[model samples]
Target: MGQEINQTQFNEQAFKEYNRRLLNEAELLQTQLTKRCFSDIGEICGYELEFWLIDHNYFPSPINQAFLTRLNNPLVVPELSCFNAELNGVPLPLRGDVLTAISKELSQNWLQCQEAAHGMDSVLMMIGILPTVRQKDLCLSNMSDLKRYRALNEQVVTQRVGRPLRIRIQGRENLDINHPDVMMEAAATSFQIHLQSAQRDAVRYFNASIIAAGPLLAAAGNSPFLFDTDLWDETRVPLFEQSVEIVDEANLENHRVSFGQGYARESLFECFAHNIATHPVLLPMLMDTSPQQFEHLRLHNGTIWRWIRPLIGFDHDGTPHLRIEQRVLPSGPTIVDMMANATLYFGLVRFLAGLDDAPESRLSFDQARNNFYAAAREGLRAQMVWWNDSVTDAKTLFMEEILPMARQGLKDLKIDKADIDHYLGVIEMRVQSGQTGAVWQRAYREKHQADNLQLVAAYLEKQRSGAPVYEWEI
Candidate 1:
């Protein structure tokens, strides 16, 4: 969950005052960056994953308030709609057997969430999109009873000049629909991985994450169906981009949610400054907290959903630190699979960021951005341009080059040898077998001529067995 606001409504005066504070904080952050005042601590791993609550009929269940009350865990919290919730992991130092630790903790939390939901005759699911969900289920009536969510709906519609949200996607099949509120966003969920980097390496880490996003998503495409139509292998990507559209009369590239304009050159503060100048603040909730906490600036940043987002966090000593959030992956096929994705991400970023000649220097920002879209559209078979500027399918690149680089990267991190082999091996098998979550779903549907409900049922059964996607059968 993001920072909660005391009130859902604001006046023009409040907006102006909030803007004043936001700009001041950005300037202060830039000053800190210039002075190298940020904390030197680095290499911390964290995550926030979004999940769905489903009834026995395999459809979205609107019972999160009751479910959360029974679960009573701070790590688990309500999401945009009553049918969804989010799970956050404790921050941990990234070394030794940390990947295994993540798998264990996430599995335990997932099991507990299921037990809580089961008490009310509901089951919890982790996926990019619940296929059985209907347009009627994503209405305002099902929106979470939270002031922040409602405020977002009001602000987005206001910014769009009351034009309905347009969602037009073309894939193996085509889908065109209009939604009246921001609730369409609730249909897509994701697994966000965080990296707390040393202040010296922040810019490099952010840029490296941008370069790795395309291939990472190619191995993790999980959402392929929405509203009974076949769309992109990772339909959530485009769905999310369209769901939160705000009218830009200036026609700027900032769309509230995007891949971003370009990689950072000098400091991550460039992102905050850009936010202050170009992106209109969505939730201008005023805070009485000390300016040192960056409350106003963070509140504004939370509303703009970048695929690779730079984060500001404070240590226990009140020392601010920089972090990079990798937001391109989907929620789940299984706990181990998510960890495998995490392993690949950490390794690739470590290797790419440490390169004497930065990978970003070799791969242009346009290629990185275009590669991401292509992978989202075509999954593992998508052709990608490597650092050598040679074109190859994502599967071929993963098999021939990316996996070796990831292994060497993890080794360089001093991560335990067994953990490296286990997790990366999972990724290797997943790529070679051509069995990402999206591919599995499409295969099941095409082979058995199964309805969406049957496909979801089979998926849930396999997911319950706690096997990775490569091992899951249609």
Candidate 2:
């Protein structure tokens, strides 16, 4: 059982005490983790993609009850909402052309989810944010009936009292959004990829991922608009940060949480220390006195902060493994598209870990952060600055530089050639066509101005019909 902390109860004394405890706990965890063998190069690799659920009528359904009653597979897991379900693929070793294996598994999982959705008249769609997710729908009433979900929601909102969250974005157009509850966070859905490597290489991989994130995200943009408004290239970027931000004047003066602090050091422990130091735990777990408590520590770490999360799991013989799970990507319109993103990432990690780039001081962390923001703001249309001395459009970078390097990297790893070509080719085609999920959604939102406010139903219908974005009939 986890103890849920209320933000309102946090005073200066409590804040100091909490930080003090977190620092001590982190030190102990670090000492224990350091003594164990954590792989420095890539060994284990995996992904987790989440989707929003809809019924035949293209409306948000309370049909999770029916779907769960029929779902029996171990892989089809429950999410925070009855209207959402998650599909976790098998973990593959980061060896011998994993692209084909990952693609086959992801496609199979999607197919399984589709099959489970059939009898219940539900469908799964991958968009940055569901177009029709209404403000009213974000209430506690609409939340999934799970203790964890409710506990998290209560903890976040209670910390802020009844004040609506403050959200502002500057893009092609400026927008301000205010929501009284945390339900607005539910509007966002994403396909997050997790790459497992040893603690030593964590910083290099994490920073390299940040550098490539802008172009990769722009090229793979699946979310262009939200609530029928042409906002950021991937609106979910801002939407997610805003929805989860729990700011009180007192807490703001003491502690704060944002997308990231900046670039990372050469070790994963730096990130763990940062999280433990900066962010206070919202949910608390009761201390269980058991010899198996070490196992529980790993599980709790997984459930903490979404960005740059610390992951600890065991291997076949119960050997504890430590890795960082990245939680800042949107789910995709195609499996190949997802694989393309993964390939570039894995390549960058391998490339960076082996090469010693100048420290975070020389490479502007602000530039990296801005680059990702630029991508979210402009999609493929954005101009990006490379880490090396060159400036190029995101599409050009992906088609010529990034994609080929990704292929080479995958090849070096002996990943299946067919899988590499197929997935990388999808990314190439997406760049040439300029029709990422976000591009299509933006076009549709523009063409259907009259139906803009229909948000959920309209978008759900278009997505469920399995039609191309251009060919979609609203």
Best by lDDT: 1
lDDT of 1 by residue, 183-248 (tens): 999999999999999999999999999999999999999999999999999999999998998965
Once model 2 is optimally superposed onto the true structure by TM-score, how far is the C-alpha of residue 1 displaced, in angstroms?
Answer: 16
Task: Give me the runs in candidate 1 sitting further than 4 Å from their true place.
Answer: 248-252
Model 1 pairs whose backbones collide:
none
Cα deviation of 440, candidate 2, in Å: 1.3
> In model 2, which regions exceed 4 Å deviation?
1-24, 33-36, 39-41, 248-257, 289-307, 356-362, 447-474
What is each predicted model's overall lDDT from 0 to 1? 0.92, 0.64
TM-score of 1: 0.99
Encode model 2's per-residue lDDT on 1-474: one tens digit a residue. Answer: 122223323346654554455555566666765664554445578877877777665556655656766877667666666677677767788777666778788877777777878867777777677666656666667776666666666667777786778767666567687877666667777776677666666666676666666766777667655655567878887877677677654553223334466676545566666655555566454333332334334433433544445566556665556655656668766555567777767765565455555434445776776778778778888888775546888878777677776777677667777776766666677778888777776666667753644544565566555444434443
Cα-based TM-score, every candidate = 0.99, 0.85
